[model samples]
Target: MHRGVREFIRWVEAHRDDAEIQLNPPATTSDIAALEQMLGGPIPADLRFVLTRFNGGVLPAGELLPAGIEPGTIGHTVREYAEAVGGDFLDTELLLPFHKTPEGSLLAFDRSAGPVSDTWPVVDYYQDLDEHRLMYRTFDGWCRVCVAEWTSDDFGADFTLETYLRSGQRHAEVEPDVATAHATVAHALKRSGRPADSLAAYLQAARCVPPLPWCDWEALKIAAILDDEASAREAATRLASYAPAARWAQRETSPGRVAEVLGPIVRRSGDPKPLLRLLEQLKAQADEEEGPVVEAILEALHAGKDLPPVRPLREQSVVPHVPDVDAWWEASQAAYAEGRLRDDDLLLDPDMVRLGRLRPFAELLHIRRGF
Candidate 1:
């Protein structure tokens, strides 16, 4: 019932059916209480206000957090946080991710601001950079800012296609920072269901930004969402310069995931060679669960390629006729070297060939992903 939350919710309801707006059904009071119980605290009044009004909805601004914080929700408000409640990332028990900035930072609540029934201050948590900073005094203030950002002259003057196109017609007279403004415009266009324009705007934004991998990834995503092969290939080709393997090794990234996204686009719109090369390099560096992710990608990339049959590990071995311990010392060095040759190639030998995740990518593979 907070005025700010109430206002935003009303605005959302009024526009929810608009092709350009996005939103979900509101949650019940009981559902809110249940979530709070799971979260081991009282839900803040304003935060609850959003959830109650829209179980989770997409506004022209951005998608809202559902009661469960599923993939498409506002922030990285994962259900996993409930169990990892006291972990390093979830450092503050009272904080909960509520929204995401266009640039991908998360806006979470400083639940410690006051009691559950009271207002909670908002904090900006940079998901990629692992940085945190104060953003607004309260959720109410944040919503006002967001609403203003949508229609305010400073932010493209409008969130609709007509306004954006009109403003673009006078590009020199409006939107000083062409790249960032276009990117912002792209989001609005996307929400409005004009995906083709959104993709173009995203491409423009990608070009404006530095050769950053994330932006390229986002561009690729936008293109894939629109099912535009050429744009996806454009993003993929850019993504190659920054080696996926090197990047994955240095940071928390998922080449396998990227492959899953790009595979289909490549299949339809472009060549998968560059993407396959990127995946191969990353697979060389990837291990464990990512192994399967890479495997899945490889399978998708070259589903028709004949693969080596699965090899069994630790199977019962037949003892070959040998000189026995008498010649052990004499043959040990040679035998061990030979055994090394027989064993799995620990070296990144392209042809050393034992079935690791990627069976030595032969062809450029393709994959497709929805936005």
Candidate 2:
């Protein structure tokens, strides 16, 4: 076995737990190194990371070949062609470079073609010249198949492997169900009006259908239309809670909805205590999960305007102990100090600090205040 083949086998063996390995006899170390040098920068950290994790090697039979091709035939062809050409043609026919996309589609670029050559061998070389021009054009069909298979396995069913095989286009199709659901919810919410009863009905209607991208934005719009202060406050609180619950449904959900829903409520209520409390709870959740939902809530809070001052619960008031209260308190103070806490920090009682520490220093404060 060649040194390259041995190194490839060892790499594949290490990644045996992952997808099956496919063999490509033509990809050489020198070729890869040269390509990297030409790019004038390291390949993305992620690509290198996957390569190291999987190691490297020839894929198993029927494993890394393209969706509909036979791996045995691919291997046989390469060997027969190599023997016929007395191995000298190996440099031109065997060496293939692969480029993988984030969506897990792979394209094989034939480096043997002088860089000045006009003709390329992409899946769709000329059908849509401008778009497909950048696609991977492998020297051999087998190399293309091998790359496509590797990419499909990495991305799994989420990637559109067939699209690449049929036409080198990577357009993602939007599901109709999501579009219709969003439209239905948006229309229902927009038509509903003011009174608490009407608003409640509207909210219920909005909740009936799962939020999709279109309706996700509409949900905030409906929340924004609240006319009564109390109604708006309730809507805001409900919307904040709803964001997390409906997150999975909104494929394209953005954090801005949280702010859009809460902005009106905070401005109309005159008291920012509820918003602050909500923010605190969200911050706690963020610490625990560190997910998109929490990040969005933090962003929304940061962008809100005209928020009322947060009144301290009370001096010496017994407050319920929350997990990581000290850390939460410190973070809250930092946010307040940075002016990200809005004007609401004032609503927090200096006494609340005592609850965390269980010390009564009211007398010391009174002395300072000239009481």
Write the residue-wise lDDT of candidate 2 on 1-371 in tens digits: 22322343454556566654443444334533544444333332322333433323435323332111122322233333345435532344332223333333333333344543223333221212211222322223323333444444443343232323222211101112222322432233222222233344334434432322333333333333333455444434544453453452342332333443354355455676787565445444332333444445445555773333223434432333346666555554444334343211222344343332443221111111100
Quality of model 2 by C-alpha lDDT: 0.36
Residues 1-371, candidate 1, lDDT per residue (tens digit)? 65656667677777677886666677876666656655666656777767876777656555567665335543236443433453543334546777756666667786666655356666767655654555565677666656555554655453454555544433312423335445555655554545566667767766752322355566666565455677877766655444545564332235555555555455553466766776665565556856676676567668755332323222421112243443432332333234432221211222222221232211101111112
lDDT of 1: 0.53
User: What is the Å distance of residue 222 in model 1 from its true position?
Assistant: 39
Error of 2 at 32 (Å): 57
lDDT of 2 at 329: 57
